[model samples]
Target: MNAAAIDTSTPRLRDFPYRLRDNVRFGDLDPNQHVNNAVYATYFETGRVTLMKDPQYGLMLPGFAWIMVRLDMHFRAELRWPGQIELGLGVARFGRTSVTCDQVVFSEGRCIASAQAVMVLIDEETRKPAPLTAELISALQPWLRRGVKGTRPDLA
Candidate 1:
């Protein structure tokens, strides 16, 4: 589903459980003198990757890989290159074989961009979607978006 289908109100960096900080380099600027639209995607990707790939998170399993199927980004304000950006992410929904994430970019306490991404767990051997395990679901519960219903009671 697209981000438009999700309700993320009053973008706050603290709302998301997963967060990281990075500088907005001069190279990220486009002719407009503001950060390029494309750069926001990379920033969002960084947040997701950092959370998923870390061994401590237990989001990864051998022989399985996560692949993004969709990403919808909303640009809210201008981002200048001379500052730093705080990225935030939280698991917003769960499917039998997929997970949806809500992500945001903030600078100086203001939301600069927001994104929702859907990722499928792929069984590397067959290159097909893999069902999420109970353990994986348990690990994800803590990363759920604040103030949003992210999972079904019956869902594993």
Candidate 2:
């Protein structure tokens, strides 16, 4: 889904189930003295990867890998270095073989960007799309977007 379709103009970090705190490194700044757009992708990746790869999450399945197929990012504000940032993510939708995630970056309570990413589960050996298993879906239920049916009700 597109950012406009989701109406994420003024997203709240609290809406995301998985969140991360990070620093805006000086090296991330562009010639314009603001964090580069490419760096924002890395910020989003950090959140997704942490949630997927962390042993506690149980989202990563053996013999299968998650590969990002699409990412749509909306730049909302300029993020400057010497500051702190918070990245947020929630699963928005699930297909037979892919999951769509809604992500946001906040700095000093301001949303720097909103993004929608689609990641497909792939068989490690054949490198082809693989169907999501029931166990994997159950594990991801806790990480869904606020309005999604399976989202953790305790999150607010």
Candidate 3:
């Protein structure tokens, strides 16, 4: 099979997860006409924030906040100038005190980059790790990917 044929059948990563679409402005490109590396990080942030703000998901409990504990990213392809991009994200693991999420940035139906993050739940006053609330979990239940493995480690 030719490269074009291979690409056509490979599932577009955007189709599998919740995605947000954005257009790349000229300002988002560099002198070389490729998207600035920093902008890809912003795309990941956009995906996470969108998920959190949705009424069906997010830090639902009063006085609860999800703080980033760590982030990891891998770049697979360069995104060139002048194209629409889609950012995809989904919960990888949800724990009592923390959750891990995966996000991908796509251009022209191809995944250009991917990022993974670990976010911990914090108590507003104590500023320390806290158990995941049932209400909060229920809110995120609809977004969880089926057949995902392993339980979240105790983060407190």
Give the per-residue lDDT digits (tens) of candidate 3, residues 14-64: 333677888887888888888888888788888887788666555556787
The sequence of per-residue lDDT tens digits that candidate 2 reaches over residues 21-41 is 999999999999999999989
Task: List where candidate 2 sits over 4 angstroms from the true fold.
Answer: 1-8, 150-156
TM-score of each: 0.91, 0.91, 0.80
lDDT of each: 0.90, 0.89, 0.74
lDDT by residue (tens digit), candidate 1, 48-153: 9999999998999999999999999999999997999899998888888999999999999999999999999999999999998888888888899887674542
What's the number of clashes in each of the models? Answer: 0, 0, 1
Clashing pairs for model 3 are: 96-132
In candidate 3, position 19 carries an lDDT of 75
**Residue 35, candidate 2: alpha-carbon lDDT:** 96
